[model samples]
Target chain A: MRATTLHGLKDIRFTEVADPVIEQPTDAIVKVIASCICGSDLWNYRGDNDITPGMTMGHESLGVVEEVGSSVSSFRKGDTVIVPFCHCDNTCPNCTFGAQSACVHLGFTVSGQGEYARVTQADGTLYRIDADPAPELLPSLLSLSDVMATGWHAAVAAGVRPGGTAVVVGDGAVGLCGVIAASMMGAEKVVAMSRYADRQKLATAFGATHVVETRGEEGEAEVLELTDGVGADAVLECVGTDQAMRTAFAVARPGSTVGIVGVPHGVQLPVHRMFRKNVGLAGGMAPVRRYLDDLLPLVLDGRINPGLVFDKTLPLAAVAEGYQAMDERTAIKVFLQP
Target chain B: MRATTLHGLKDIRFTEVADPVIEQPTDAIVKVIASCICGSDLWNYRGDNDITPGMTMGHESLGVVEEVGSSVSSFRKGDTVIVPFCHCDNTCPNCTFGAQSACVHLGFTVSGQGEYARVTQADGTLYRIDADPAPELLPSLLSLSDVMATGWHAAVAAGVRPGGTAVVVGDGAVGLCGVIAASMMGAEKVVAMSRYADRQKLATAFGATHVVETRGEEGEAEVLELTDGVGADAVLECVGTDQAMRTAFAVARPGSTVGIVGVPHGVQLPVHRMFRKNVGLAGGMAPVRRYLDDLLPLVLDGRINPGLVFDKTLPLAAVAEGYQAMDERTAIKVFLQP
Candidate 1:
């Protein structure tokens, strides 16, 4: 089987590798149908995150179960499924409370960018699609594995509700999907903060009622001015940088919540500021497994097109090109067909 | 008029001061019937917090309305009212959402240690008691001015639910009161963390189902062990120190909330840990006004004795002795009659 592997900074290789086998009684082997590069992948690609040579490269994918382990009762061979980024037992206290991302038995199953992958804890981690769908629906279904579910997590975590306004920070695919999420969650106004024209356009197409082409203080001021000085009712921090967080806090209304899902780097919260405004902060690694049940149906019915985030698609052999295109900002997200 | 003044570190003085009168159209003058020394007040008295000479030094009080400005329609002479720690217009977006403590027109009214206090934003800041009660009821009613409301805020903010377990950090009056608040809010088990025998007794009396004398990592292990290694459903952070915050986070079950109402001094959140656990952090300065209407009746009807925290009381001229007793840890809370 050919799988994507990371050797060093900026080094992505698609080469023949040993096929994954069901090592554990609860594990299953999946034939990958679709996979994609995530923004978080860039952290390792850019050498900002520790990366070991020949490491498995992706965490999001849609696939067909090729083989089920002895203990896997929930899924069987040939079942179309969405593989959430993290693996959990589902029956653990955390998973039972819908915090599968923080499950006590959580395992990072980041081998999605491959032709074949082994899934651990198959019964709890795999969400079987109800029926077979066309190949064109792969990208959208694959998104439920991580990115789309992550965006929904942000909106829900921020407590987005009817008649409220949501301010989305970041112009990446997750941020764009967040606009869709907030809108679907019944936010009357979805404000997308973007500086790039293409991303801004995508944001608007995804239900952003307003777009702010500013960052930091200016961005906060713009959001405040747009909301008549009361600030947005919910701030979705899809970007985890300090600047994005500051803007999220600044533009949040006094009683609003800021849901942060972006992998935080060097982020220190100003507790006093949040305290003074009575603002609440909640969001972390999203429980993608928990959201798959609700969001997959919308994609299946074509009510939402979260798959639109994939601006470029490539064959498994051209996986390097996919990484290069996203690295240079040529593609918001790149879908890979295995 | 006689008032308590801070001249320097450890220098508390009962000195003659000019009488206060209503200055703003929204102000009213109240002749204080009861006031109390707060843990935060000791910060200035102990020189931990910056203090200006002759600064009027109290924030919690219940008093009789002596005079009102033309715009003060909420109260007139002889009316009894609970003066919350902070003054707010109560019409701002923040106040409208029940976050009066963060009101846009917020004014820190700290003259409760004096014989007379000129209340600003009188209509919103004063919650008038239906009738003047006997001296015995004064302590409990005065508690509505700050401590009781603060504890209630912690419980409410932490999202305590029926059948859930709540862990209260700190043995202070507010923390003991939090035990009561969590119990009243339907928490099946209220765990109070205390080292002092007196505070533990008070905690039990205030509805604490269990008490843990351990601190830091030991305390966290104890809480986790008590809950069958799952941790508590809600953790009330009544202390602002980083260690306390960490313990609060550690004891919180996945998907639980930590409500912090302590005046934070040196606190930096370990966001990654919090995120990974799916633990939420919320709570700040309590919106005392919002809780007054609901809690006052409970106190009045003897359903809750929040005022039992006032273990010592002193005459107007003995304000120095009141401060001394609290400073030396001889009293849990000291009520001052002026």
Candidate 2:
């Protein structure tokens, strides 16, 4: 089998590797049909993160069940499925409370530009898709694995009820999808806080009722003006910077929640301000396992097209350039067809 | 009117001040029968706060309505009432949300310590007792104005549902009262985190099933063990300190809330950890206006006795000593009989 390997800064190569075989009774081998470059992937590709040598680089995909171990009961060969970024037992106390990412035995695969995923704990991790989705829908369906779920989680944690006002703080694909998620969840007013004109257009198309171009205090002020000074009922912080966290606090109404889905690079909350206002906070990595049951349907029915976030496409060899396109803000997301 | 005027650190003195008069159409002048020292007041007495000199030092009391302005319709002269710390119109958007503390046009009672509160926005701020409370019941009923309500708000905001486990992270009057409030709100397992024996006794009597002498990581471990490694379903943070805030977070389960009613001094939140677990936070000054309807009944019905928090009592002229006693930890709360 061939796999993508991360060697050093901007250095990724396709190399011959031993095919993955099930070592655990609960494990299964997934033949990857499609995968993609994530904004988070750039963290490792830029050598800005703790990247181990010869690391497999991704966790987003749609695939077929090439094989399953003896103990597997719910799936078989030739079954198509979506692999959530994190693996969990789904019966742990954490999973019961909708926090699958914090499961006692969480697992992940680094076979980014891969031909297969050796997913452990298969019964609880993979979600079978309907009737082998068309090849054109492969890229879109695969997104449900990570980014879509992340965006949906942000909206869900923010309590974006129907007619509720929601504000998304980041312009990344996840943020864009969060805007769509908020709308799908019945939010009547969806505001996307983005400075980029291109992303802004996509955000409006995704159902954002308004777009504010200001940053920091100005942005918060614009949100207030749009929401009639009451502030948003829910604000999603998709960027984990300290500044983004503060902006989330500044734009939420008293008693409203600031859903923060961004993986923190470094964040120190404004407790003094948040505590005084009774502003609540709820967000984390999308518990895609908890949301996929509902999100998958909207995708199948065409009620939502979260795939719009994938603004670029490339072959397996262009993975490095794919990372750069998103890193340079030239593309929202990039798909890799192996 | 004679009020306890704070001049400097530990420098409280009784000084003659002009009695309050009707300042607004809804304002009512109430002659205070009794008042108590709050934990937050100690902040100023210890010179740890930025309160100005000559400021009257109390926000808790039961009083008699001595005079009513033109628009005061809920209470007549001679009525006995409890004045919430915050004065609200009961018609603002904040009031509708049951967040009277954040009320628009909220009026402050500057001379809060002495008799004669020029209680503005009387309708929402003053709760008239069906009958005048006896001098003997004043102290206990007086606590209903602030600390008890504050504790109730903390528990309620933390989402203390029936049969839930609630951990209170403070053992002051408010913390102990939170135990009573949690039980009242249907919490089955209330854990009072306090080291002081006297406070522990009070907490136990108030229905705390467990009393753990916890102060940090060890305290968190104790709580997690108590809940079988799941942590408490609700956490009431009644202390305004960084350590207290962190403890509240550490002791709550995923999908639960950490209600903070403490006047935050300098609490830096662990946002990353909180978001990852889907924990929610909501708090502030007690929205006493929202709880008085139910809490006052518990007080009147004798189901709750919050006044027991006051271990010492003094006449109005000796309020300076009362403040000193509370500051020195010689009193849980000082009851000043006017």
DockQ of each: 0.78, 0.61
Model 1, span A1-338: residue lDDT tens: 88999999899999888899999999989999889999999988889899899998999888899999899998999998889888888999888877899888787666789998888899999999855778788888988988898899899889999988999999888998899999999999999999989999999999999999988888888899999898988999998888888889999888778998998888888799888887888878989889877897899889999999999999978988988999999999999987
Q: Model 2 scores what on Cα lDDT?
A: 0.85
Candidate of highest TM-score: 1
CA-only RMSD, every prediction: 1.2, 2.1
Tens digits of per-residue lDDT for model 1, B49-145: 8778988878898888999999888789999889998888889888987789988878766789989888899998998886668889999999999
lDDT of 2 by residue, B1-338 (tens): 89989998889998987777887788988888888788888889888888788888788878888899898888999898888878888888767767788778687666667866778899878988856666667877888888999999899888899998999999999999999999988998999999989889989999999999968999999999999898898999999898998999998997788999888887777877886777878777777788888987787788998888988988889888888787778788888877
Question: How well is each residue in A297-332 modelled by candidate 2, as lDDT tens digits?
Answer: 888888888888888998877777787788788998
Give the CA lDDT, 0 to 100, for residue B28 in model 1: 87
